[model samples]
Target: MASTPRSVWHNPVHFLAFGLGSGAAPRAPGTFGTVAAVVIYLLLPVSNPLLYSAILLLSFAVGVWLCGKTARDIGVHDHGGIVWDEFVGYWLTMLMAPPGWFWIVVGFLLFRFFDIIKPWPIRWLDRHVHGGLGIMIDDVLAGLFALVCLQLLAAVI
Candidate 1:
């Protein structure tokens, strides 16, 4: 069971932190949030790497605040329902990725893998860090790892 906060619907901050309500899912909220992120990524104009990078920068900054504030409000360090990190993580994985559904699916799978596995530094940060930045950093690193794998795969194929 997940803590689906009532504030998620009524509060904008909570809503965003909840990955626009996708994080409210009873199970695998992070996966659902990542799915929502794929939709959002498709809607954005990311053909330009610079623009995409800018979007990543801005979203990451705002996510730190949004996630931190929501955690404070909900009194949870990183609630299962708070999945803004997933949204940004998926976007980061897709940065500079070759444009195609195959690539998108690959990126999605890779991001999910790294996010779930949380190898080494990612796991360490998740355990040691606190608040919004803590919540966001692990996912960011996962995305970066996925990005590297995806890019390498793209190069090989």
Candidate 2:
């Protein structure tokens, strides 16, 4: 595995792209980043889907730049440690999610599952895409997939 960049600590863009430093974990950085995202989810006012959607849109937009710049600076395309995508992905998974720690945990697991498994077009896009947008698109899809599943589960149970 590549070394975690020191710039992650000192550079603001790298820091943010690294999921506020959670991505710097020695192993399972994406998981750590998603965990960090869980904290962000807790602080957000997710009762309003409009507000949550706005936040997801802004985060996705900003994450492209943040992830792109950090990858370029570090000379790695979609470095495992650049995990702002995970943050946005997890938040997307929780869109309109039921209010409770149970939902939060479920969202976390679902997002992580799809992210790691990279099902269908997600795997294809992850391989075909490049740059900052490349870094984000797969997780974005994973989040979307997880979102659909979670919403369905919510409706059923």
Q: Please report the candidate that would top lDDT against the real structure.
A: 2
Instruction: Encode model 2's per-residue lDDT on 49-126: one tens digit a residue.
Output: 898899999999999999999999999999999999999999999999999999999999999999999999999999
Q: Candidate 2: give the clashing pairs.
A: none
lDDT of each: 0.95, 0.95
Per-candidate Cα RMSD to the true structure, in Å, reads 0.8, 0.6
lDDT of 1 at 146: 96
lDDT of 1 by residue, 14-96 (tens): 99999999999998999999999999999877888898899999999999999999999988889988899999999999998
Candidate 1 lDDT (Cα, whole model)? 0.95
The per-candidate count of clashes, in order, stands at 0, 0
Inter-residue clash pairs, candidate 1:
none
Evaluate residue 111 in candidate 1 and report its C-alpha lDDT on the 0 to 100 scale.
98
Cα error, residue 134 of model 2, in Å, equals 0.3
